[model samples]
Target: MFLQRVANRGIGLGTLLERAARRHPANILVFDHDLDAAPQLGRRATVGEAADAVADLASRLWASGIRAGDRVVVYKSDGFDITLLAWSAARIGAVPVLLSPQLDGATVETLMRRTGRPHLVTDGAKLQQELSEEVFDASQSVLLVTGSHPRARTLGSFAGVERVAPLEMPPDHPTLITHTSGTTGVPKLAVHTGRTLQARFRPQAAVTAPLRGRQVVAIHVSFVHSRLVTALAISLLRGYPVVILADGGTAHVADLFAGLKPTVLEAHPNSYLQWEELADDPRRPLSGVRLYSSTFDAIHPRTVQRLLAASERPAPVFGQLYGQSEIGPSVVRSFSRRRRQDADGRCVGVPFPGMTDVRVVSRNGRPPSAENPGYIEVKSDGRIVTYLGEDERYREQVTDGWWRMGDVGYRTKWGCVHLLDREVDLIDGFGSTLAVEDRLFGRVPQLAEVVVVPGADGRAVPVVCTRGDVPLDRAAWEAAVAGLPPMAEPVQWKQADLPQTATTKIKRLELAKLLAVGAGQEA
Candidate 1:
């Protein structure tokens, strides 16, 4: 089978850095923020130094009684060390359950309870500010990455602890656990094995195979995401020097990219949206970038057009991978500098032949089309084994080995998938809310974000955030929405006020609730 042919065995996350060091010990890693676990090591380190830090941290975790087959939950403040801590936990054969820093205290407690009293690894700010004191009570034992806690011992306290050999587990053993985007409700824990993760890496790595040796690959994925693990691994193992961003602020990114001039860039779609203004920067921060890559959601064509126009490289391309946390990237679509600005943003792209398959099932007993969309189902070796502690819930998504993506879309005659709206977010008679949003983005240059959600009255409502919170030009909006599906007057809100996932995807359902009550949401 193609799956087994691509990667017959699992890739080890624990010794990833160590393995990379063997081939490229001097490969440099630049960081914007200092690592909390190894502050003395500073913000920069070589592959060799990074490997040593992971090994050192693993010893500390072992000395603290984290053994093979155990689960360790890392819920510290935002830092690259969150990923390094995951590596360290895996080094000792303990499964790493990563929680996003964006998750609220109540949500964390719910996840901790779901993990069934797993050992918690966190920091001072979370303990004092965000998390409840009961977190300690819900954990098997709490370990601190930073700050003091009487109930927890600092990870650094075990600095001089004896080091142990890295334990290797079978390919099917649960390697990592990451949560979903939590757009609707509490996020579910997605359990991943080494084999499944490596399957995901294979397709993504193939995307970068065309690049030449030693391109400066800068990554800005969330620290706790499973994609970060494979993104780092692919770069490190391939000997590409890396630049990791802890902050996605425009000024910080401009200053850094002006100096380093990365060749390849990877970030979430919304992050790219946030950096659209960087195109006009005098320094041409994206000048040297050859490829712009994003995964997990559909990107706006307007955002793609602006970014590609900013790139000075010959034949720059924007690659979008449309999939979910439960299933790794199922389809890919790439946009080039020459592509028209009105390119169909809904056509997410085609599946990888032999490796991944996609099918849209009919909903109304008719062939699915733009008028009547259907459920998007996909099959891939990269699919997560199950939702941790929610086996039945996971089973509900799988039917005869195919995973339902919980998205409604139709396939084009050329085989491209047109993602319309999420299953739960669909509005009756409002043909494709996403297509409407895409058209709005293309029509309104001043708009930063526009989400179409159903109001309590079942009318489509557009929630808009202007670029700089500037007052929306009412005339421009009126002209933009002309001849389109009818919607309530645009509700203007500050971008920060919008409920977003860790990946920066706006929560449309949550936004709808806020607008349903007519709480003066208009700007």
Candidate 2:
């Protein structure tokens, strides 16, 4: 069945789910957080059940006047229902724009305005709060609330609606819209078509084909992101029973893993950093994990080392994919116990031979060499067509066929991609913040995370978090940074206080702002 589907010209995003349901009727589709629990637990559903739910919801959306080519905005807290509803909208040929609930009301409002006031699907509680705060404009949108509200129509009202047949869309029809993490500025909505999504998932499916139906897969990432959709496709197509984790707190993940004992685990890098302590936990939550996958950003070597060691599986592997929201996964690398200790976190491996073309072009237009690092550019078939409502901005980043990655890095003599820093976050005196942070990892065993950001004087400053308030060893720190740039006295911050995107990447701009304020108080 899978072989036949792959031969099709293009598969619609909604069709993918429907096919999965037909192929694996009793296969589990979702494990959502239980609302009534003190320590939240998950509730399970089979693929057929989930497909029915999507059809029911799609009918309600169509009854609400949404039609082909119409836009529907889904703004809700993290939950399986958010993903289900997004796919439901797609099933009816309505483009679904998924916004993270973690985004502030102002950001949400800004995104809504840019999308031209589409129909909004949100919970009554969130709608009321945003409305009361004057951040959301009620007059511009028709509200579809999950819970009862005076000003909105409840989703429950359409619960009894008959299931509607899935709509057929052209391969290039826009099906999903999601925003960037907003690390630099207001997030831009990235538009994706079914063809683009299929392009992205094809490579992933090929690589993991060997593990199909044999591994229990567990995922803890933002449901609203593009990666989640790809993940769902991979799990469903491969017949892997999935455990979706909405709450990524260490305790919740630990509890879930203890019960499920997944053999394959995928999450944001920072999430793995937070779970390093589980390596030592008596429960041994990660013991059964054979594969650990991280995307979005480069992960620290120490974090990777610890996780690989935690897995009792003899040959545990860590897979890292370095790419952006605009383009799908570009470069890929795998780490095993043999290479764990000597792994350079900055080296993100080479681009897939046929999947992408990568180049490092210097500021002066010279070809990149090891010594002369420059901005990284990539040309991939899976790249997004354009940013919704920002064609000019999108075009600015694309020159000819290559897309500027907004990153500064150089390719090694062996063709590996070594990331230095985000173009905006590069500290003038410091070579690479990621490289510096990697060096600091082993120097202080208790240091959980260390970030180098520009200070008020424009010099590099290190902000660190130690495990359980372990005092920093001044002598060790001085020795570790011996030949490196002179850094400002390290500022201590609680791990939870560091601002991060939904993908678990530290907001370097925000961190710099925080440090500058601290410098002022000291003065």
Candidate 3:
């Protein structure tokens, strides 16, 4: 609705490329394969070449039975292929859905069922294993194979449809239909327009590295999520040679850095935290990276220490800051060493150049003072596009153009803002707002990992782990925890190796699910 009401929005991704082509036709646009690994000029395509490629892909999609507004899903490992397909879908007003390639066959099938996309653009093997013949018959979904898919029909097999005809798309055309992680609940689709994404990126263009030759590593996972969205756009717009990590596991990142030697590393703090465990690893130090950025949460103190120690050169370029799907491709950035490593919290750096307004708000939805942590609400140069089916969620979340990201943090005594926790993560067990496991981990050193959630017995419980030796020092641990406020202590503590997300974060929802399942078994 917000996008529909806006004016002069360009046709999402393709038109942007058309404009880019017009400005710099010969400028190198994208570099796909890793120079060190597969070493191929993945594509030396200029803006003009890119635009032409989109048209070619559009023709290909149309021949394969896709049409305007129809969903075209991409679940592949290659980021360059994803970009080309996404751009092609945009060229024909098709809703491009990008998904993580790591998803198993069943998950991919389920997602396809949910989107009801008539066409799936993936390579051969996935088609044979994941997609059922019945499901294919039901939707008449064409499997367009790019790489070696063992079970795919050739492009010539589907002949009657028009090859590649360019279709006009409105400015508010939806280029991307992305989904949240759905770790806590059902994954909801968020539709983004050309304008929404471009406006978000334009401000960041000035703040981020110039769109030219640079070795950039996309450390984030590709799951039709905002983080991947930013990484892709930054790579394309900045003309950076991207090194896509085949694996995003905590253990794999160090190897990626060592092999690729990227100039810029776009990473989340969870991975950085895991890097802390390798502080003494001989190859821990990051080389070639000029700017090291951490997003999603404040860099943990341990992680900061590791990074500080790992830089090959003196005074490693390190910084941490905030951004969300709703308001920022460029939200708030802190480059200063003092602010970057300030675990106590500070401004998320001054707002990006075009960010209009950002503030700390109370639980009741009113603005809070610099010292009081509250929800982070932002009014940016370009607000979010909108949720697909949940229009009310959008309306309620965005007030006077400021998007209320559910995070709770306060502005520092200075201009910096500090995020405490998210509203959903704070349990109301005994009526006090507390960061459940986050607080406990800080208190208990013996615990290697912990996840606190509402237990089946209608009380808060923390599932914990230790390095080894089941030292049931419960009395000591409880006494130490008792010093914490009532809300901070867990009513029960269960011991186990903590479950982590693919991104290595403790899966709180999965933990809740496990608790519910255990309750069901007991019953």
Candidate 4:
């Protein structure tokens, strides 16, 4: 694997952005909201203008007392302004943490406390409504707003301070931190350095199908973990016109493709699978999309097939990527229809061009056999610098040279890798081991989405959402589920629209809580 044996690069993410700015100063760097929206900031921000703005912001942030190694949380959805802030923070050597704008003040507080940084960068809405007036008293650090929406403080306070310009830093400098949507417990923050990010983007960096200097519409939220850091960055770095839709949800995934005609479409499985509802429409959902890629969790193979079939071209434009916050973006990728046929929907293609190594190992540390599954260990130049607060956990994750990802997978007889599931998501029930996804979707029909979740009582069941309003024939679904091996049938089924993460993954933990509340009410 390309990610395993390679050496680290000395170049950091700050240097990369500077390189891009110099190469294409006049070109359009980022396009926010819609092409026609006037309130949008990046409506006309050229590369030179964006670079200058980032430098200006960086300088102001530093002058306001933001420092290198200090944690700065960015609580906004995907847009030109927020991303540019991220670049600005990196240039100034500040570690900017990406958080969901939807996160409540309590959750935000918890995250802020974890990094021991009281400063935050957020929109005007959150500062007033969610954080309340106390956010200023809650932290000793400064709060900077993204736009003119009246945040905790105005940007004009530091008038004459020199703008912090981009500078070269070591590749191992901690640039970004994101929490993984863990299956079993609270999310863990995965750190990534500039070197790790470069390795992840190298292979697909040159492939600009959907976002090739074309108008790109991103519905994926910035806080949804890996989408923004991985797939979305690939588009932004290419100088594509990025239009981030703030109001859209999974329901609008197909619409973004059809309406925007993006050269490429990057979304999550749940978002793409929902397009099955539009299958009956004579018009194609993703009519003008040149490439469609998905990452985060494994998108079911059936979902991938249906998405391909539903597209304007029945041929596969689907790309499956494997990535993590700790390891930066995608280190592996599998693309095309033929490749889809051979995939189980969980194989995140091969290692990217510069990724050092990726491997599946058993308990003994040797490679696992074809029939055996083990922890996935990868070593790359692009791995994270360190965890935010969990130094011990971070150390345990790093072995001799590889980072032991808690995911369980093994290679095929032909040497292709297949993810069985995350080790954390394994459910021990009826003395049989199972992945929640395998039990739920394998038994359901035409399922737009499903989550195999552990109930309050520790029993695992299915929470499902279908594409249409058609009532499920309970008897048929029950019989079909019953026919599966005993371990596969969900203990109970609760059908409703399943909630999704920003990246379009079913938030099983959220659903489980919902289902638990419903169960309590029934009792």
Candidate 5:
């Protein structure tokens, strides 16, 4: 209703590119890799060509028996096609359930079962490698996005299928379904309707209003994320040339940015952490950036300062938003060049004025404070209606109009929200493991990743990964932890060895369990 009342139309992913083409037919989209679904289209295309590709893909999906109200699960290899396939599926009024390529075969099978045996879109590489034959057992039918399989028909098989007109569904129709990060266990599907998604779009889009003309927007966000829907919508509709990356390796990104010189960029916080090295590159990959937006929560202060410094703009702003898939962008904060390098990373900004609100509820009888952080709860029109197959589970997280963020934090006197730790991740004697890690990040520049979790012996352990896989200097480590709460001698591990969610968020519990078996223990 928010979007309809303002724009007189609802947010429909299926027709997004088509609408964009109407406004700016020649707007360009550049990709770091070829799209698996439309590899023939090459690495770049005009908005009009992209619209035609989506329409053609929609017809093929319709020919494959995917219809309005049907559920189609996309579990293909990692590529931008994952995002475009979502659009094509929605164009035909089929709900797209996107699972990350990082998920193993067992996890994919589990999710497919949860999706009511939906038709699966995947590729040959997955079928031969990560996905076991069990996926076919759980899926209604297998349709390949690229490579072929004896059990699945390839999208190329339906090439000449007549284009189908985009179907118009009600504003409340389920537009997309994306999974939770699954840090704790099996991920749950979060369902989003058009109107709810558009509510998220408004506040985020409003922030970009002051920018004159068009700007090239480069993004390295996960392909399956709900944020991509709104992000692509905002950029494309505004006639901005776009750059999308499938890989987040620093070398690849450095080359791309150096050559293309995008003005606006958005990426996951961890990706931003990785990109900090690009600041010192001779090519000045990040110099042209005017706005740095981290579409994830609680980025380290050091990473923020490093990236802002890389931008040669007179006044660059780093935008950080705190939220999860269940509730879209609950709160936002921005950092300018004038801010201190050691700004408090825990103080994740305030809620959106009218579109979002937050209240900290005490777990104990005492008032919520830094020492006794309370449960972070939020109210947003953008909150999902339900978990795909777990309505009761979704209901349990909501009280009145507020949804629990499952994080413990307190609001400052100035109304700044200070995130302390995940409620489930809290340690018995530790004040805030996250805060300690934040401090270590700022003090020791060598740390690429630092996670403080409970060791098997019940002592707080700091697991660290250094940039370039170099060993951390012993003296610097000691000096950094001098004033902090006591922790075990640091355990060094390769960043790849640490368990991570699809979004690159470290799985603290999984790492602790693995540590119980001497996994990733470096002397």
Candidate 6:
């Protein structure tokens, strides 16, 4: 709450974190996951300890020639250390660009180049491998290795370096840069000023304030994502114990939750889908969960039903936020056990009354109406300043103050938002692909995940993953799809086989390309 108040005063994002550490020094800030060991838990840091770590790391970065206004690109495996480094860069008034480890080497190179040859911070071994693979450019950039290497200075080697004072900047000064999930094409870096980033956290604190210090908040979203940073800030400021999980595998999640029994859980929608079986686990790992939060994409109705049913806590609720990387949470809706069945899979509810404004506009510029679904646009305080190196592209999406969301949806008569599909992914014959997928989910009880993409012939193609290894029942599948546009034979994929963005949304464009190449020939 103090952080929220400070954010309202337009404080810098880096300074706000420092204030949180001072306010709640001894509170447990994070439970980081150990990626090297499958079952072992990673390290934990208190607010004071985390703050000190970040300050020390910031000194080290300064010693390594990073100065105010410089850009430092962080490309490392998931862990709390990445977070510390990012904050450290911000503290020194440098912009930190975080790249997901899930990104391919070529994409990484493209992002690094786009950042104007920013300094690279990554594992030494990984850097070498990338260089050998011809994906890294060492000629124009400086490298700051996180691990041992003869060619680069390691993070540990900079211990006890001289500390530098945080540079004072206006609230609107750029402090962090993160890329879009790039589901459609090359990822564009979304630039966030302290003002924009702080605006995001203020709303979160307001929503969760009542449960402050009473909940053990567990997060399993992408480490490089903006959500992680905001969540960490909220937990530290509110004195809630925080747990961070690096992997979203069902077994890993079960193992982690079995011991923690977190009261609040937040993750990507697909991560929740992967862990849906945990709802029925004998240990009842999710039984203590009081709140479940999902963002970035729409979640399935059946998944929400099962998860809420799994929780034994009285008045348990599932909070869904529909948003994008460029803008923070635009719309939010909550589901309780009583209302779970009433939720439409595509209805993302209404925009936050004062924080966001949403409009559905037709291609020819007609006003939005319930009868006519069109492109969705949003004007929000949390919108990013600009896409790094893509100013013109970013400008193209904005008209007046509203940003084109590239989504096809309409507002309901009740003032709720019903999302149909991404503009690029809309298939003509089947109407809304998401609506059809939701119908299939209701009929096919064993379905785990389903994505409808356009086929080479321009018809809807349903690509799905069934729960566990149980084979699909052909008769049931056929019956479920009876009236839909004639589909390409349903392609069955392992959940992990589907290409995904950092936030766990299937990369529809890439997945469609794989299907075109006959990746799922058996279907």
Which predicted model would earn the best lDDT?
1
lDDT of 6 by residue, 303-382 (tens): 88889999989888888888888988888888888765435788897877667778888865776543456999988878
CA deviation > 4 Å runs, candidate 6: 1-11, 15-17, 30-32, 35-42, 132-141, 340-342, 364-372
Colliding pairs, model 5: none
Error of 1 at 278 (Å): 0.6
The runs of at least 3 residues in candidate 5 whose Cα sits more than 4 Å from the true structure, single-residue gaps closed, are 1-9
C-alpha lDDT of all candidate models, in order: 0.90, 0.79, 0.57, 0.58, 0.89, 0.78
**Cα-lDDT of candidate 6:** 0.78
TM-score on alpha carbons, each prediction = 0.98, 0.93, 0.74, 0.80, 0.98, 0.93
Error of 2 at 266 (Å): 1.0
Q: Give the TM-score (vs. native) of candidate 4.
A: 0.80
Judge candidate 5 against the unseen true structure and give its global Cα lDDT, from 0 to 1. 0.89
Tens-digit per-residue lDDT, 313-421, candidate 5: 8888888889889999988899987777677889999987868889999999899999999999999888999998899999999999899999999999999999999
Steric collisions counted per model: 0, 0, 11, 14, 0, 0
Q: Indicate which candidate wins on TM-score.
A: 1
Which prediction has more favorable lDDT, 4 or 6? 6
Q: Considering only N, C-alpha and C atoms within 3 Å, which residue pairs clash in candidate 2? A: none
Span of 10 residues, lowest total lDDT, candidate 4: 30-39
lDDT per residue, candidate 1, 1-523, as tens digits?
A: 3344654478799999999999988898999999888786687899899888899999999999889999999998999999999999999999999999999889999999999989999999998988888998898899998899888888988988888899998989999999999999999999999999988888888888888866999999999888898888889999999999989988899999999999899999888988999999999999988899998799999999999999898899899899889999899988898777688889999997777889999998999999999999999989999998899999999998799999999999999999999999989888988889889998999998888888889998888989989999988999999989888888888888889999888888888888877743664
* TM-score comparison, 5 vs 6, better candidate: 5
* Best of the two (4, 5) by TM-score: 5
Residue 227 in model 4: lDDT: 47
